[model samples]
Target: MENEVQRPLADFPVNIWEDIFTSFSNSDLGSDKLKEKHITLKETVKESFMASRANPIENIKFIDTLCRLGVSYHFEKDITDKLEKSFDCLDFNQKIRQERCDLYTVGIVFQVFRQFGFKLSADVFNKFKDEDGKFKAHLVADARGMLTLYEAAQWSTPGEDILDEALAFSNAHLEEISSRSSPHLAIRIKNALKHPFHKGISRIETRKFISYYEAEEKCDSTLLEFAKIDFNLLQMLYRHELACVTRWLPEAPNGIPDSMKHLYRTIIDFYDKLEDELEKQGRSGCGFHLKKSLKSTSNGYMQEVNWLKKDYTAKFDEYKENAILSSAYYAIMGVTFVGMGEVAKLDAFEWLSSHPKIRTAAEIICRFTDDITSYDFEHKREHVATGIDCYMKQFCVSKELAVHGLFNIVSNAWKELNQELMRPHSFLFPFLMRILNLSRIIDVVYRYEDAYTHPEFLKEHIVSLLIENIPI
Candidate 1:
């Protein structure tokens, strides 16, 4: 028990250790710590299960099963007894506990308990075991119960011997339970079950956890289901190893041939020029008349232009070779999600109603519009459309079909925005209102004053961009 009491302090400050211990109870250990604990617990749980199977142990205590679950050093019955008896001794280390708590609290915020949800406070564990006239059972059972929830939610594989051991622990005290079910625990179990391997667990047992305080009925379950599906997609992507590479690829290529390396380089240079030209346009006029430069009039420039067009075609042909399938999949998925922004805005409005935070709402609206205006979204859309257009172009439905599909996505977004405007809710209304006023002021200044065109005024304005006039 001396070692057990010092374990948290030894590895981390006292307060930090307590916070980690709280994590064990909060049940997020599965995602973060399950893999680490698996090796240690494997043999112990197997042995315990085998032992129980060999003979019907009458006491069937949780500690007996816990001994098989894994080794925590303090998990041993004798050590647990010593620690419980000596907890008061360690209680003197207040500074350590505070530090540990702060660390653990950070983890809780960045991970674990995300979003706003009620966490039930109850004794969580009840049955206690008396070994050699010492209180050892309750501590073991409490720790084991918390461990089971963490592992159950976290384990990549669902029904390992450790989980069986956990069930055995829960069953041992089935007859003498006094503490009510934890709402958080129930949510954890439901989330775990969303995975295919865990689907077979007794739904009846899970339902017993349903309580009056479950906030946002079915929302948690829906999110859990979606998260599981996305996780599996991620897992599949990882297995294929394409999840890592697609981010750095260019958004658009004007058909370049790989065989002619010189032409490919020139094409990229042209696009760089295009980017500069677009930036210039943003600062000045929306359109420009093309004037033939001396270089463009030369045969060498004409050859390069022709070569650029050919190479663009070649690059499109080689896109599959250069890009990962998962990269393409996620790119398209991102586009789809962005297209869903309008829908999300509508949902946010529905959620916030008329009392939406106009400031936040306007920011969301601005972000989507800014994406379109800056041509960031257009660049990606053009790349994807280029590829898809190539394949489908043979069909009569090619160009028109692709355009219709993109149009539909954009239309859906606008419809969502309209709905939000009609009935905004949550923080949307207030946030949108604030952003609208700010955008309007900027628009008015740009239209009325040529100050943006003046270098000194531009420098001062850019310097003061995010600064507010009043103190917060």
Candidate 2:
């Protein structure tokens, strides 16, 4: 590779995480008594969850709690079966419908269904609007209701004008009520506004929700204790995973530049193993798609580099088209499906290549979220034109409006992502979850700033998830 062009240099911070995971290993967190207690509490929670099925409202709330506590993996099949039944039944669709329920209950059901990819109409919220097409002013007094609607609205798909209105209504009112609410509700609103649970990382959001759930008047002791135990156990596994990953890290070759070798080798080594395994499975053709995605992503990056080198700004449509690959969502998704075993056959890779709405949504999320937040900082350098830049110059708008416009694109992507998850023909739910989880990471990495460049914002989250232990 010969690059005669002089490139821009960035003075990135030193690695704060150098050898930090060395302190973690399975031996340190071992406690037989805690394990036994975890087993007991898990059974207790399971029984309670199963028995709660008698009440429609209570059952949905129970499901929400389990997920929010980050303990749903323990009873994934149980919850899935229940949701499956509910999905199959017309009654379940209407069981917790907004028309028959208050704003809070309706919001809960909407969010839970959307999160799991259940099809529910956004029209149910239409009744809440007054004849004048505005949310009833009186409803603003219902802080809990407002908060729930705000969370529920995050799942809105394209062309859902009412949901768009609902979003604006809830956002404005939540800001208004935050100052006057009780300490607990105020904190919940603040956190939701800063980091929406629907779009937030699973462990990070669950950690915050567990504390809030513990304070609820209806909180069950058994469930609370189980969540705490499950969190600690998972924390150990995360630590162990980190340690294992660090131990086997390949030494980059001296022949390649230091900056390029690390990432280049990591990708090559991972795909090499993946291709080898697929050959064993006699699905070697799957490797072709993997390579295809990898090549496309590299091409996208190269295209961006060329743009910066030539100081050329791409048209808005051109930028978005290239971003599909540049976002690296497709490349990541290729390997994400590898973990599905036989289910990830050759045609599954073909399906991914088709540019499904869900895939496009995830890519948009990755691109726009980073662009909107990091553009100013990046613009200060010899950066390629970001989506924000393309949109701004194309439309000749102020930076603030451009940011807001790009955010609408991000929001629509979320809606499409939510919509795709509910489709009947979608791949095994786990595959879609890979996309969701990856999208969630965008919020974590670029919520207020690009935490990758500014490590300070990310340090606390890394510590919370991997290093700090949840209290027993």
Candidate 3:
């Protein structure tokens, strides 16, 4: 008995045995071509057992062996199941510190069983389901897992019954369990529906309702209410600030305001009242004034720009104490906030584009307008990244479906722009593209480092392209 026990493991040095086992565990071996028919299952099982025996749990290589073997559960089920038992028997956790496999691996294993048409009971799956499970990461990992299983199921022999298992697994997890999760799980469910092997799965139909902003559901009514208040506050802030900057109304024969001093104090008093109102609402003065105010202020600044262009000697701050210089300085601070707000709006738009179904073009424009009105541009990249992560996780395998819903946004924008052309004071194509590019730069920011931190980098690249009529 001792020799029999020792003999199986004794042939291999500990390192070689562990290496062989690790390779088997981690590799999706079924994905590889099975060339040698002579090596039957019995033979393969015998070889695997021999390798495990040689290394043993006490060997230094056990942890690496376990990691690979855990991964191998995807490909070599018989070997893995048997190995699982052996490890359990040895109380391997006591022998060597072993982290329970990653939750990602759990999803992958479940996905593998699913592709083979194995229908695990709901009770079995509940073992792993938790609200806090790295919900976003699982979405991406599971999508990749499903893709692999799909191909394998396709190639397997008809009577092998793997396809049934795959369908059953998909149904249980995706249709049954996934549909019940909160809409926040939309990104993951979307991706899973796109899984190539989803032919027999019926649950794909249920994902339509699960999203951040479904047709029947909106996230927060309070946020919507606050948005309107925020918009009004912003407009007020802009008007008050503009009054402070432009205290000098030209003294004309019939004009009412000749005293700049009196007007300046009135403007300051108006701003203080407006500030109090904004404070009472628990909103930021920066958010209230940044976006709309910045744009309108920019129109004013353009006049200054034109004056400076006509003559370099033009004094940008000619009006002292209460005039041009004060306005320029304060306006610059407001514009900085506007710049950040523009960045955030752009990031949100890119996210909408990536998941078109969730955000219709009309919805995208509406949201853009809201952001512009509110000027909430702080933490632009972080929001985009987090949003993308949500998208990838929610719609992991169903990216096309989510994207399909988004097409109307661009189409609608085009339609609106065309209609506006007939009206006077409409936005021109260049101006539209320039503003859109401000949003487009968010997409570019993630793709290349230059666009994220540097505004001029986008400006130079885009302006050159615009000048040359280059296709973006």
Q: lDDT, candidate 1, residue 365?
A: 31
Best-fitting candidate, scored by lDDT: 2
What is the overall TM-score of model 3 with all chains considered together? 0.18
- Select the stronger candidate by lDDT from 1 and 2: 2
| lDDT (10s digit) by residue, model 2, range 265-348 | 677777787898898997778888898899899889989978987899998899999988898889988888887788788988
lDDT of 1: 0.30
Cα lDDT tens digits for candidate 3, 257-321: 64645554564555466446544544345334433333444444555445434532222123111
Q: Report the error of model 3 at residue 96, Å.
A: 83
How accurate locally is residue 377 in candidate 2, as Cα lDDT from 0 to 100?
82
CA lDDT, every prediction?
0.30, 0.83, 0.33
Worst 10 residues of 2 by lDDT: 252-261
Model 1 regions lying over 4 Å from their true place: 1-140, 143-323, 326-328, 340-472
Task: Summarize candidate 1's per-residue lDDT along 321-354 as a digit string, tens digits.
Answer: 2222212221222222222233333233233222
Candidate 3: what lDDT? 0.33
lDDT of 3 at 52: 50
Error of 3 at 316 (Å): 46
Q: After superposition, how far is residue 383 of candidate 1 from its true place, in Å?
A: 28
